[model samples]
Target: MAAADVIFLVISIIAVGAAALAVTRKNPIYSALFMMVTLLVVAAVFQMLSSPFLAVMQVLLYAGAIMVLFTFVIMLLSLRPEEMGETAPLPQRIFAAVVALGVFALLAFPAIEPGVPAAAASLAPPAAEAVRFPPAAGTGDGATVEFGATAYFGHTIFGRFVLPFELVSILVLAAVVAVMVLAKRDLSKRDVADDGSDRDPPPLSVSAAHAGSIASLATSTQPTSHGPGA
Candidate 1:
């Protein structure tokens, strides 16, 4: 209800709107710019919340670094020709629009309909008035608590939940490798044959058709070589 809260809400709403536009925009460059705006607005909201760490991360990681990368990638790929092609089919286009509308409805329905408020009531813990446990003696020294020391990085690789983490890492590595391999073009087969240009030799099927027409074209295009100059 405060002025600051109202400002924060307005910024958040604009950030969400810009992000949606980023995904739906027809021009990739404009989409990237909108994404950058969304990220900057999110960083501002984080700053308003007093979380400087998250705010800095949002600005540096997303707005500065990731958005630049996205913009450069969109520029690198020559998509102008493809952009002029036909749009999505009517059935698929309608289905996607319906799904998007359904998601918006789900988000808006809760805000509009107010029921008995039983859901909120049920979320309260039954032991709300339970006695608290006193802190163990000598535990509150000036030393900082390291949360992940025993649970993760410093622990053995075979620790609990390690399998899930390893699986995720493997999946991400595989995806990176697959994308790199697929993006690469095979130029090893390109070589200079009797022709001047360095290009891949024609396939057997094409070469056979070319061979059949070569004699006829050569007879008409080039004079016959005779022993004496006539």
Candidate 2:
């Protein structure tokens, strides 16, 4: 195998192993750390693929920002050890494994085929020679505006994929709102009943009940002095 292929193989193994550990670990903090490792390894793989922008995004957006958020949320929740136990049924685990294996097969099969390079080239962006830029307006001498990968990426995202981009933003906002709603303790439900009144008073304590009975008996047994009129 070529050196690049060997390097890719090593990185892929590390990324997958770390990702698996991230999900399966019992401790949330440890899981987050493992996830960071996975993200960093994936970023390295992106760099190897000659996509510096993607590598930077993987590090900054996922490893740095998102992981920090995850760690903060995990710490804020203060999860107990018992709460972290694996609760998924055996059948669910088996099904998950099967699904994962199927996905792996689907992805790997195309990549290993001899026609993979041609397929990938067909899907890739147009070559530099094929890119046509409109003539610069000011000068009669026709000059095409030269732009880099970042400009192309921005154009593609804002121009062609704007709807999907906006939808993703809305989805993220909804997720944030949902998390806030879930985290903030709802005292309204706890302090009031569904009928919009205070909850029923707790049953009287044993001591209070016993004291009331004793007082009643004492009142009944008390001897009353005869009044002057009587």
Q: Score candidate 1 by TM-score against the native.
A: 0.51
lDDT of 1 by residue, 1-230 (tens): 99998998899899999988976665656666788899999888877866556677789877886666555544444344333344557898799889999999988876777863567657643442212222224755113212222222222234444688899878766665554445346656545467657564343332232332332322222122211231
The C-alpha local distance difference test score for the whole of candidate 2 amounts to 0.64
Pairs with backbone N, CA or C atoms under 3 Å apart (clashes), candidate 1: none
Model 2 TM-score, 2 decimals: 0.62
- Candidate 1 runs further than 4 Å off: 47-51, 81-84, 105-167, 185-230
Cα error, candidate 1, residue 213 (Å): 45
The weakest ten consecutive residues by lDDT in model 1 span 221-230
For this target, which candidate reaches the highest TM-score against the unseen true structure? 2
Residue 38 C-alpha lDDT in model 1: 95
Which regions of candidate 2 fall more than 4 Å away from where they truly are?
114-117, 128-148, 173-230
What are the RMSDs of all candidates, in order? Answer: 17.8, 21.1
